[model samples]
Target: MNRFQAMAQIMAILCEGDRIRKGSQKYKIARKLIAAKIDRMGPEAAYSKAKWNKYELFVEIEELLKAEKAGKILRNYI
Candidate 1:
């Protein structure tokens, strides 16, 4: 998959882990770690500008899952 698709997969995995680990401090810390990884992958300014859009993130997650189910290796998205 392409860079955007890969990153979306990583983010979706992180989100799932966060949901599974809810109510623990580890989940909060993992979220920050995932956010930092994403920030490092792209232009920080652009990422910061779009980071508040939850709907976009959700859509990206859906796309990522589709990619994953199609037998695409998406670990590079991280």
Candidate 2:
């Protein structure tokens, strides 16, 4: 993928629910961006970047999943 796509994929993986605040509108938007990028790059490639360990990426995926779950229940809109 290109640089923008690459960065988007990385951001999508690295972001956490706590960072976005689960109940906020930002959380809902971030969740969608994460899902789209993860779908394009595949979760493995999206989370695993240079110098990052597999376990770390795995943790990121877990966090993304949590964000996804929280986003589903959240009703806020941008």
- Give each model a TM-score: 0.38, 0.39
lDDT tens per residue, model 1, 1-78: 444554455445545635425544444443444455556655443244335554455454555556666777656553
TM-score of 1: 0.38
Best prediction by lDDT: 2
Cα distance off (Å), candidate 1, residue 62: 0.5
Stretches of candidate 2 off by over 4 Å are 1-18, 49-78
Superposition TM-score, candidate 2 onto the true structure: 0.39
lDDT of each: 0.49, 0.51
Model 1 misplaced regions, further than 4 Å: 1-51
Model 1 scores worst on lDDT over the 10 consecutive residues at 25-34
